[model samples]
Target: MKKILLITILSLLFFSCENLDDGIKNSNSPNQFSQNFGQSVQRDFMGQVVDENNNPIESAIVKIGSNHVNTDSNGVFILYNVNVFEKFAYVSVEKMGYLLGSRSLVPTNGINKIKIMLIEKAPITTVNSGQTSEVNLPNGSKINFDGAFEDENGNSYSGSVSVFAYHLETSNSNISELMPGMLFAEAQDGSAKVLQTFGMLNVELAGASGEKLQIAEGHTAEISMKIDNTQLATASSTIPLWHFDEENGYWKEEGEATRQGDYYIGNVSHFSWWNVDAYQSMTTLNVTVVDGENNPIPNLGVTLTDQSGFISSTLTTNQNGNVSGLIPTNNSLTLEISGAFNYQEQIGSFNSNSSITIVISSASVNTFNFSGNVLDCDNNDFSNGYAVIAINNYVDYAPLVNGTFTSSYATYQDTFNYSVYGVNFGNNEFSTIVTGQADINVSNTVSINDLVVCLNSNTINLAGDFNLVVTRDDGNIYTFPNEIIQLVSPNNYKTTTTGSWAAGTIAQDQGYNFSINNLNGIIVPNQGLCQGYYSNNIYGENYNGTSSNGLIINNNEFYIQYTITFNTGPRIYTCHYIRN
Candidate 1:
């Protein structure tokens, strides 16, 4: 029994050990096996599929090794999971309408990217046989024989071919004559040779109208041509070659015919057309008129007269105050404008189509009348043999005046009368006068009240100096400085170191100041006599070749005060001195 029990225990132990070994082996067995190592091996491919016309082909099949993909909407495809075991893989792409395309690709351990381009097969619609129909040519163009022909399928055919052209000599009849034949060879070789028969028919029609086909005034013409075995014929419908006058306008018809149908057909009339006649003519002569103030004159009437006579037309000024008149012929013309507001008559002339500008100035109405008596420094009347009143500053007024005024010595008082005529004020100068006498030293004071009188009046004052000679009891002549001297306004005196009359120098021996009063010609001394002479001794009696029996005074050293009044509206007073 003991031996049996030991055997049973050993058997049990052995079985237990066997079971443990089996469990261990079972646990070690692989659950799933990896076909490709640890790397995620994938194959990538892209390609474009296009037709003969360069149009994208969709749904194209792309294969790389055992992998395959379809083209996308843009004719592009991608293939993945290409077997890495293939050192050189065969890649092929195909579509229903495209030719088969293939490429060789080398597989790597990683991703393999490749590009495949597929071209579509030419369409069956392409001409496979050499056959075509003829085409008509335009009326006025010349055709070139050597040209290319292509079909819709992109098939090309090249060979020598011939074409015929027909021209109708007259529209009145339907008869036509065959022109010289044109021959050409296709640039490419293929089934496209059939398209050559339907190509353009080049015809050159030349006659009176160079290279243009013409029909009679009233007729129709039939044109027929042939290419290889094809024939094409057309007839021009009846049309009027010349325009006819109608009540409304001129009428005619123009149209074009083709194998499909007639096109660009319509009836044309003069109302839809226009005739141009161009010409040139002399229009007018532009003229500008200005007043004395150089301002444009508005509404001024301008008369035009030619050598023959006055053109009965008159032109008025525009907004810019310019006048222009149109004349038929180019000739010399005269223009005139009436005077206004004390203005003188103005006349001007110019040739036709020429421009003229006229300036009109105001005329002088009357001569200036200056009547006054010579007075002394004490406001006493000057008694002299002859008191001569001379104007030194106003040289322009000298021509307008008669003999100047002179004081009479027998009267013991001098009454001066002076008239300045036809004096145009402001153009030349303002008026100034100097008075002197022999023997008795007489200083005169002259006042010009109307320096400028229009809307506003200005007053001017002027003074003159003179020396007197007296006979003493011993009958000897004695010369002395005049007691009555002209006094100038302080504002008119200018002090300069280098001037003719320097500062502190004696401007004149006698000085008297005068002013305008009551618009009357009256002489009175406003200031006492000045006791200075000119530094340069200017305008002395010796230089002027004057009789020195009386007191000699420098006229250029006197001072003159004047005022100016503008018509439009400003009033100004100016004071200035005359230097020797």
Candidate 2:
């Protein structure tokens, strides 16, 4: 369904008849999203979703392989025991008010943490379907449509048409994380090629009632994107345009755009995330991230920016502490790790493939790593087990190999507050998990070993639909009826194969997520009905109350109640799920 809209992500440029310009600056600190995932087992994947502002966004749907999950109030979602292929996975996010966001990454084992920043949709511009109309951006970019629009059913739309348009500034340093996938595209001949973008635009249309609409058959719309002044001297007179296939997450070469003065003007037969980009001559660039000890760092954020604004995107290091992608062979580029924009250097040589190694430095003393082993209820070695490891906010899985496992060792946060649990996979049922934790000043590689565990408990299926209600301190009540929920079972937690859990919340417009432990109804940490004060802010109303199995609700239903404390007072949210 998200393929229907063009996700105009990046440095925001809202369209208007009048100029509304905004300037952007780059920071050495975190720009957009950051990933803290450690060395992980390859079976499960999890992460958080955030908006362009970097705050956690709840209810965003995350799809990977054939599994999907909704972000909890904390913007955290997990997929257990899912399938992955050849070290890479495709991840996509969908929220109502934001454009679709997706990426391709070499996934870590369990607890593959990534923060995806969804670009909020700009306000719609209304135009008559029967008359020519154009929406101009602040920077002089515009999309001109020559009347005659059609609804989704192929019927001509005669009334008002709503246009949603956005332009992405390629000059921004953070463009690596802001754009849709890496600078890669499918050529007119179906071969994949790396892209060096000149400019990008996403155009979308809806009818009077918000149903999908498009330019009439055999008609076309002209897209004019303003070229950055800094690039005009080097910009080509003519460029091939590419359109992103939102459904497949691939950009395809579609049409051509001619550079006119300061803009690239093109006529497009259809709408998608269109880009004026040229195929770059690329060679494989392998980046290895390590610590002072020369150990590999897994899941570290790596960004490659073509100084000329031709190629840019962020990628994460894999389990071997390596990130391998095609980079422009002829252009100079900058490579930064984990949001450190200050460190810039030429990565590799031209023409031939190259490998570069970099170290993650800190103000600390030694390396930081995770390693451990597991035991069963009778103190027997448990080979078929997986461990959930959390060091501060860096949560991930450490899969056991013959009852032992090791993390990708590297520099990490100074204070290592940890929590670990070993889940039994011996019988495909997680009756219990061995749990442990401790706070330590992480000066060097920390290994957790000889962990005693057992299948001491079980979990119930809390998957279904229900009504979620939240009441503010001043007595304002909001009710969301029929919120959907799903929970996959284990030893392997393969919850939903194709379906997505969508809950309606005044706080979480996207929805909420949670996994219950039948042992004590202790839901995953901060995974309950927490939302932000804003629409679906997961931390808005944290459950200060006790836990429930979310079952045994009058025998015919189940429920979850939470109390949130505000500066003014307190409010209670009773998410009462009525059974059929």
Candidate 3:
């Protein structure tokens, strides 16, 4: 029994040991299997990010192959845990306000250390200030701007301010919204710094400035300052500066005023007041014409009248609905703009010393007194027809449709009758015609002294059982019967029968003679043939006496088709008659 007890104990201990061994084996087997199946891929990359000033940028993003990483506070970034022998990877560094940088690196056996330096991004400088100061600089020279910052009440700010300078390229005009120049410097201090190495200079003021600026030559060097935020008004003044003339490669400052080949340099600030006497003076005038929507009117005719009869000129508005011109001196001026649709005349006077814009709206008063009617060939009114009435000349072959003749004169009538009011009578040609209709009158050919009425009629005639025979001076007789006739005549005529004739008979056999006569007389022979007869028998007595069947009629009994050859003269006629 003791031996059995020992064996039982031994057996229990062996089972316990086996359970422990199984647990250990299971854990160890899993670890060994994972070691054989899984693998760790490490990807390493390094790069740097900087600003346009070549200063290191922090918190930049770095991308290696498919892995992404960000730089610490020092603008350094790296990627790890990448497969070394898998494939070649790329390193990219990205930062705001800096150009993106990228590089390729092939992983070796161990940790791959790649150093990438990112380039500074190009600066983006746009002109957001309304106050533009253009400075002309000498070639191969530079300009440094130094100015003090002040508040709206002329108090200086105590904090460090940012300063920016722009070199105005050829594309930097006052009308442009973009500043196409190299950024000279962006300094955080209040000291002066050079902005551009060449071309014109434009300074942007961001911190402070008073309503007015005081600039002196000796007290301060050539400097540009930021105007006060309260004084940051959109209103601007233009001061024209004279150019420095160079002759034979030498600077010539004398007799610069009368030179023909002169150019402009820049604007005159408060510092330029010392040389204000020698500054070439110019007067600027701003002109603007607008429609009812206040949109700029393009291709407007502008006239400036002084003592001279009239100085006529034309100008088109810019995108800002304004036009500018420079005058030599100040004088009383009257501005007139013609050829504006739905716009009135805008006239005013001002001292032409500074840039000014003249805004012209539609005229308040209607001008010109005009009246006319549009009539058809039958002298009937055209009910819904439009007429285009031009004063001087006809521009188009067709009448103007939906077009305004003047500010107050418009034609929308099928039958037009207008009394043009307040018209300044000059050498004017009045041409009025209906749209899509034949021109009834050509006033361009008529003289101002003779406002004669031109009457034109187009006649369509049906053969009225009468044969017409035309006897020409050459003794050639042309006959027409049972045919439609088209004739143009000044005096419209109706068909009338003169002699009695029988039915279904040739017109020449019928006792009827027709004649056509003009003012000159005997244009066409009085000859016609009737096809039917009409008789009014009284008391059943047939008064069928042949009333001279052979008739010699004069040039008055018959109406003939005719066309006018010329104006102010007798109409030439070509007659057609019927003969059997």
Candidate 4:
């Protein structure tokens, strides 16, 4: 960093506080007044003081009309016994190393809490060019240049230099004036006009739009300063150039200028204007959009906006997924890109003369539309229940009226398609065909019109206990409460406590449907002399492979044929065995 000379141009503007509110009692001095408003009444006011950076300024002096106080370590201050009728009052804040802040406060319902932000004082600069120069001035003030002059020959000119500091106005003043009640005196005859002997030259505002020559927001204000000397300047040295910040009401040192022949070039961030003692150009910006696979993704919308309030433009990517246009180089730029429904939107920031590529992830969107019917075991329309379809954990429901239902976006898929409808519970009002397979793909419209969902009306009561007898191969018999066996339920029409095959008590209302308990204690008469007691036709093959196989003795309609292989050959033994 280079140490350059900086001068404060303080133009103080004063506001008229002459007319005081009638409700408020006036004192000769602003700092002198009664602690009480009237009638022993008091109104409290609280506030905080901070710098432009939002850091709290502790011990700062705060004045609310006649009452004054200093902020604590937390930068908080309070004023008590304020006149309630006074709608507004002047508040002045002062702290070292910071510019003074003053404003008017309007109390609501006799109370108010406020936050005051104070701007830091611009650093005073000293100039040393073989000869050193320093301006002796009072504190809390800035210097303003009245005018600049030069001889026709462009040689060093000498004249009287007059500087003035203006006071900020209270009544007619506005926030735009950084410091309130501050101004400079008018330059007089024989005043020191020419501070130093320097040739006059031109400082042009590059990239300025109109006759007003204002720099656009988000665009840099290029300042080109030409020195009368024919010698070319280099970046190794420095030229002092400052940009005025309207918000902070101060002048700040701009970046170093690049030397080109007799001209020095510098860039200003914004148009609030610049006082340069610098020149300018920028180029086209190109943005590319690609997928996570690094392949070009075309037809994406890209917009570039200047952060400094410059004009913004939008363009669409070409087949190559690239968009290019002339963009501002005077300031920072922001890029916004958007693409297809599945891809995510992106925003990026870049500097001047920047061209970059953005990568986005391609997302897969899957949605399923279902048009199906809900039916009972007899293939009859089931109208009492609602229709529900779940795909990949995303479920959509519709009312089942007249056995028909239609749902949309009711399914999602990844890798493969799997969906179900109206078949959530094992104990349902109608038999359900939950294992039906439907072949479908993602992002495609598939009609599930043939999806015939069945309902099962079986419900088991686990509170009651039931008994079952099992005969093992060793000829040992074991009796147990149905709860002791796992996964032993018989059919889709029967409900079990376990989702898999399990032995459990059946509800009284449901047990009668299967009538498995009737087989208990029934004796079988031996019909032949071959061996063990056997009945000709008893056990049926209907419940053979179901959970009810071990418990149900017979279905009463078909006889069961048991095939036993003795390792030598397949021996088929058919018998109807009843429990005694």
- Model 1 alpha-carbon drift over 4 Å, by segment: 1-42, 51-55, 109-111, 123-580
Query: lDDT of candidate 2 vs native?
Result: 0.57
Ranking by lDDT: 2, 4, 3, 1
C-alpha lDDT values of all predictions: 0.28, 0.57, 0.29, 0.36
Which of candidates 2 and 3 is the stronger one according to lDDT? 2
Among all windows of 10 consecutive residues in model 3, the one with the lowest summed lDDT is 1-10
Q: How close is candidate 3 to the true structure, as a TM-score?
A: 0.18
Most accurate candidate by TM-score: 2
- Candidate scoring better on TM-score of 2 and 3: 2
- lDDT at position 443, candidate 4: 40
* Two-way TM-score contest, 1 vs 2, winner: 2
Task: Quantify how close model 1 is to the true structure by its C-alpha RMSD in Å.
Answer: 54.1
User: Where does candidate 2 stray beyond 4 Å?
Assistant: 1-100, 104-123, 136-141, 171-182, 189-191, 226-237, 259-263, 290-293, 299-311, 330-348, 359-365, 372-406, 412-415, 420-580
Task: State the displacement of the C-alpha of residue 357, model 2, in Å, after optimal TM-score superposition.
Answer: 3.4
Number of the top lDDT candidate = 2
- Assess the local accuracy of residue 70 in candidate 4 as a C-alpha lDDT between 0 and 100: 75
Tens digit of lDDT per residue, candidate 3, span 270-303?
A: 2211110022123345566554445454434454
